[model samples]
Target: MENIQHRNINVNGINMHVAEIGEGPVVLFVHGFPELWYTWRHQMLFIASKGYRAIAPDLRGFGDTEAPPSPTSYTAFHIVGDLVCLLDSLGLDKVYLVGHDWGAIISWYLCLFRPDRIKALVNLSVVYNPRNPSVKPVDYMRHVYGDDFYICRFQEIGWEEEFAKVDTKKLLASFYFKRIPNPPLLSKDFAKMFNPPPYTIPSWYTQEDLDYCASKYRSTGFKGPFNYYRCFDLNWELCAAWTGSKIMVPVKFVVGDIDATYNFPTIKEYINRGGFKESVPYLEEVVVMEGVGHFINQEKPIEINNHIYDFITKF
Candidate 1:
């Protein structure tokens, strides 16, 4: 991995740390949960080598960045505001935006709220959840499907504490490499994240990666990232301001077919109706890799970087 320089800047008065490489068209990579700027190490080098300025920043509470005290600070608007201020801090009028997981959620909201600032939008893993004027994510999911959905449970109390208490070794093991146990604990174990046996996170995560994440959570804790869930109602409420809008900029989305998210019966409809397909006026592509999972960037950097390069270069 290429070692890059870290730059400190104030985004909306919060101290934010960003790693930047190369110098050309700006391509800002935003990482997801349980990850940091280091997660984009491969992409940064690949984009930089192509003469583009590649930047990856730890979202407010995720890494070396400042973790605001209140869970409310992690709201969609606030997260997007961080990016806006980050762009201003870098003196960038607009830049190509690429994000994964939580970052994709924020990127979608940013595109909805501030399309003028993104030259192109590329998402990994997380797809845009369409706004349902009358229902929340949990209620909507329950209404469409049964209540066994894991994310619905993630919204309940003590979830963060459970996640926080997980063995860092196990968590890292799951992400770094694919070593899923046979008969994998799927729907039966998400709520039992604190349980034993196959319930524990995989061993693919290295100690170094685990240490990096654990250190950050030790200071910031999971409350901020968890708050992203708490704001579902708020997100829907805020989104009411732009009910019928679509992401009009050039866009691309990629995900792993094995991602737990695709298991949802509504996932296909969500992708089509939630603005990834022809719904987005300028959407360029949507790719679903057969064997990858939620951690696309880390699991398959070459594919991620190639798609990104191909997308941005086309524009």
Candidate 2:
């Protein structure tokens, strides 16, 4: 965490907290769900040492960034708008992009909505899905996966009440793993499921890392973080204007073979059958890391940094 500079820059009507280092062409990192700008700590140092300015922001919520009360405010347009405005505020025109999890989703939108602002992108843990004019994304998930699906559960009101029962550290820690079940669902026995016996933190992710994130979440609560899910249908609706659009930015995608998103029944087939590259026409490569999980960046920092550098350097 040393040598990193933190500051708040007003963007998109919010004061966005950014963690930055080095001093060259910018590498703007976007963090994922339940994560902060601090999520990219390792990559910041590594990429900065490699001579590029490394910048990571907490997105619109989930860290020091101000969270709007309405979930409707967390749409793809809103999040992407904040990031774009951040670039403007910082006097940047275009920068290399890196994203993971929700950040990956937002990065996809960033490329789709404003490819002119990105030199190249390296996205982790999510594949680019072609815009389906017929299916509302969340509705499709509910139809196939049922209400027990975590996204469905998140859609229901008061899911955060359940989150409130548990400590934030334990909640985030349960998710750190090498592999997670495909189609992750919430069982009826909620307490037993989330509040099970304590376990040790994985060596790849330290107690300090967990503590840092937990401290942030403890202040903001999980409601704003879950707001990203709350806007799934809205993002789909708003993006109707962009139906059938392909991401124009050059991209390199990486995922863990065991990542839950990777294991989604049709995801692998789609990624392998040329559908992913079809949507992302400029996709430079796809790297499937063995035995990794949803938290790909933090769990495999060196390899992730190597992957990011390998592709971005080409630009």
Which candidate leads the pack in TM-score?
A: 2
Query: Candidate 1's error at 99, in angstroms?
Result: 0.8
lDDT of candidate 2 over 1-315, digit per residue (tens): 779999998998988899999999999999998789988999999999999999999988778999898888899999999999999988999999999999999999999999999999999988877668798888899899998898888887778778777877878777665255476788655555775558688888888888888899888887887889999888888888898899999999999888889988799889889888888899889999888888888889999999999898898
Q: What is the C-alpha lDDT profile of model 1 across 235-271, one tens digit per residue?
A: 7777787777777788899988877665556676767
Q: Which one wins on lDDT?
A: 2
TM-score of each: 0.86, 0.97
In model 1, which runs have C-alpha deviations exceeding 4 angstroms? 142-150, 172-207, 269-275
Off by over 4 Å in 2: none
The TM-score of predicted model 1 comes to 0.86
lDDT of 2: 0.87
Clashing pairs in 1: 172-205, 173-202, 173-203, 173-204, 173-205, 174-202
Clashes of 1: 6
